[model samples]
Target: MAQPDVPWPLLRSVEALADAPLAQIADRLRQATLPYMGSSALVIFTEDCTGRPQKKAGEEEIISRVSITELDSLRATIPDEAPWFGHAEIAGRSRAVLALKYAPSHALLVLTDPQPLESTPTPGLEMVRYLWRIAARRIQEKVADAPPSYLLESRAASAERLRVTAELTDLHSTTLETLLAALRSPSLDDAAARSTVTDLAAKALVALRTLSDRTTDLVEEPVATAFERLREDLKPLTRFGGVEVEFIEPPLNGRALPGEVAHAARAIVRGLVLTMMEEPEVSRIRTQWDCDGENLLINIRDNGSGTLSADAPSIVRLDRRVQALTGHLQLEVMPGWGADVFVTLPLDPPTRPAGDVAEWNLAARELEVLQHLVAGRRNRTIAMTLGISENTVKFHVRNLFKKLDVNSRTEVVALAHSHGIR
Candidate 1:
């Protein structure tokens, strides 16, 4: 007799996610949930991977244009509760949404234009929620086990995004402030109507600034807290991997690490420990971190056959991560003894050498202003671009003129262009 037809689709989805790469998780998750719930879009906002917080799949227009302000606003509505269903602003327009927050990681899952696909709403909702929980947990799990290349890429992207967000907040804040001033003017007619609009604008401005601050917060973590979290990340392995592991903590007063650095550091050490554990002779591993105000020093040693090869792919990847941050890694192996690994990660990013335009000895900010001027941006425009005041832009421009030995803005631009400052 033929048994019941297995739920091949569901099983396949689960199997797919089990080994899905990080870049494809959102798409895979969306496909998995589609059978249970119909939606135009699926978005996962998780701070676990600081580099790329939003993993999205759906209408390209919506996912591409969705703002942190919208997500933060939705997240705010469900402080102690989740599974919120309503119409909310998404991608600059209002869309029906199903929002869920994973309490474990505060990760948010938003399904836009959602509807039941299983004939009844309750059953579909329950299934979607369960799938979300699994996905949310998987998000952090993937981050913990992320490869060196992904970690490095995440750091670069996170840093650039953070810089852009801060600038955007400053630029828009100024615009909104001007709008508020105009709205509050006694010369404007319809005072009451104007006042209501002004209040809403003020709130939006506040939310915008709050979103920028949150982005900055995600870019760095206190060294002590980062290390503590690392311990937590490795706790499972220590408990179940059947190996003796010890952690020597760094000082509480150590400098805060850039989010990427903290993550890379943890991943580097974890990889080392795992590689060492692969050796049958290995029984114990010890890891330690210390900060000397300028660098994060890491040491991991293992009692093994000392067969860990420096040229191994895993070791190479780990070393590449260290070098990406302008850090150094050294390996010491003794055949009869064990393996000792040393890593030094700089607390501060490497100072970038000045470009061809540096011959005039222009400071970084001056060169930035010069670049904008070459592009024919006025003081106000440059100020907006750099998130500085117009007066500060003028100051930088004046300094640029003197440094480049140019009299007028035109001459300054010409000189910059001639020197390939662009």
Candidate 2:
């Protein structure tokens, strides 16, 4: 028998989403669903299994107003691989919540407005599901067709860097143009013109520096490069303190960390090193970074009287900073032996609380996949355990990756461990 044909509108919508930029995909999805949802605001968001939002594209005010707790609650009720439709009070008003499985991501498509669910046709739910499937498939295809994750991240970093460079250049030119224009205007006195120029220069200088710092944060630095930078930063501190610093290098081929993480890590280590050097008897400090699949394991030891208290002000400040990144800091002060500082900072964002796992809005099967993943089971092993095909296991794995905001199995496991999942 001949197969039935799909609708042209559905096909066209999927094509548009496939060709759209990543930032534009949410808007396109929202537009595609507006006809059926008629939601005053349509929010299409991707959340991890732990219910943490990874990326969202939608109306700013609506997105900002939506309670994360509400999303988490809705996520808890939705079944995976199925569409959920129901009425719930959101932002102090009743609205329809349609949660669905968008492959490689889970979507909570919410509708709020002057139009109520009772006013909309029931067929709209089916249409929403159809559109979701198309969008999900297109997203999966795009990801599959893309380069390796690292290269993609690196390219994104480079693009951001270039964008900032352009912005700075334009700002410089604009400031010059403004000053030149002011100089030529005859309405203002010389003193007034000079004052205007001074004000503009001050503001421009501040703006330029702010933009530069933002761009720096956006850039991705390889762990090796970050380590080298740390070494350079510590040189003056070490030389002045009369301390010899030793840095044991990790494999440079590992995945790179985000600029913020790298910078924070460097600063923390520098602080610890400086603290050790302050002791009159301390002369040597040793540091090492180990990339063990997921977390960056840091070990810093110093040759000093082991009387350093973990509660010391310097150690306390470093501890607070590490905790801010969802990392752990431990001090092994052997009294008479040198102190050992062990820190575990996740390469990705730390996992949500274990109880929040249910809030991640994962389907039953995906939950199973996540369990196996946390147990360090390979894809084939998981497939066999679940009596599912290897390809199916891979499908779940990819979706898990999107939810977890990670690119590798190691990262997933590490994150799971961090959240006490395993």
Candidate 3:
């Protein structure tokens, strides 16, 4: 005799969620939970995947419009592991919602317009919670073990997010300021109306500023805290990998790290240590980080045979991640002293490639193409992402080449970096 709750259908649903790719995991989760609970939309936000923090699926109108601010606000209200069920602001309006937070990673999941498939809501909620945990951990592991492609895409996405946020902050702040100014004019006839409008405008301005600050917090982590998280990420390895690891903390007063930089830094160090541990002679490893106001300097050394090969695939991958951030990696293999590695990550983005937009004399489309090029996206990827044809991308690329006076993609990328076109 078998329990009905443990049927093959349930097993298949779990399998689907576990095996889905990063881009499709959200959709898979939605499908998996459909039997237990139905929702108009589903949103998952986890800082672990800094490149694309929100993985959403469901009603296009709802999922498409949900903002990080709204989600963050909702998460603030939950305050614990319990599933919060009630009306909350989502996608610019209040809607009945079921919200849950994965405590360990501080990840959030929201189901809009939720209804239990079975009469009892308890079973469905329990099952959905179980599935969400699996998906959350999967995201964490995938990001930690991210391939080179994921790393490149993550960096590009992160930069675009920062750029967009900056523009929106500036735009709204100006608009709100103007409104306040107009409402407070001395010549206004109705004192009550003027005062009410002025009060509203002032509050709007404050909220705009607060949202701007929230965006910044989402993108950056204090240097000290970033370093501490890195140590925590490596705790399991140190505990069982049979290696004595030392952590040299960075300055508490150091600048904050951009979300992508923090994520990459932790991944880079984890990869390096893992590679070092593979060498039979490796017994101890030391890692340290320092901030000189302009860059994050990382030093990782292992007391092994000094035979760690810089050409190792793992090292090469880490190097790409460093260079992607406008950073540098140096590997010094002293025959018997063990391998010492140094990584330098820039604190500020590369200066916009062209000091003045007019210097490039390129059309708007060409500039867009160039930005994607700098992100290490292939023309095909750029085309798909931009929703334009590959041939069109080529047209823009050729124009960029002539305008920037660079012949090869490598030269174009190098020139852009040199000019600070991050």
Ranking by TM-score: 3, 1, 2
Q: After superposition, how far is residue 345 of candidate 3 from its true place, in Å?
A: 3.4
Give every collision pair in model 2. 40-112, 49-360, 51-360
- Per-residue CA lDDT of model 3 for 1-422, tens digit only, reads 98556477777978987787787888899998888999999999888776577888899788768888999998998879999999998999999999999987899999999998777444998999999999988887787667654655455455555665677778988898888778788877888998888888788878877887887788789999999988888899889988999999899999988776788788889889999999768999999999888888999999888887778898988888788777899999977779999999887665543455577787888888888988878999999999999999999988886776443464466555555676
The global C-alpha lDDT for each of the candidates, from Candidate 1 onward, is 0.80, 0.65, 0.82
How many clashes show up per model?
0, 3, 2
Q: How does model 1 fare in lDDT?
A: 0.80
Instruction: List TM-scores for all candidates, in order.
Output: 0.66, 0.35, 0.75
Best by lDDT: 3
Error of 1 at 228 (Å): 1.5
**lDDT, candidate 2, 230-289, per-residue tens:** 788777876776788998988888777655456567768878887887764677899998
lDDT of 2 at 252: 84
Q: Candidate 1, residues 366-404: lDDT per residue as tens digits?
A: 878877876768899888889999999988877875675
lDDT of 1 at 368: 80
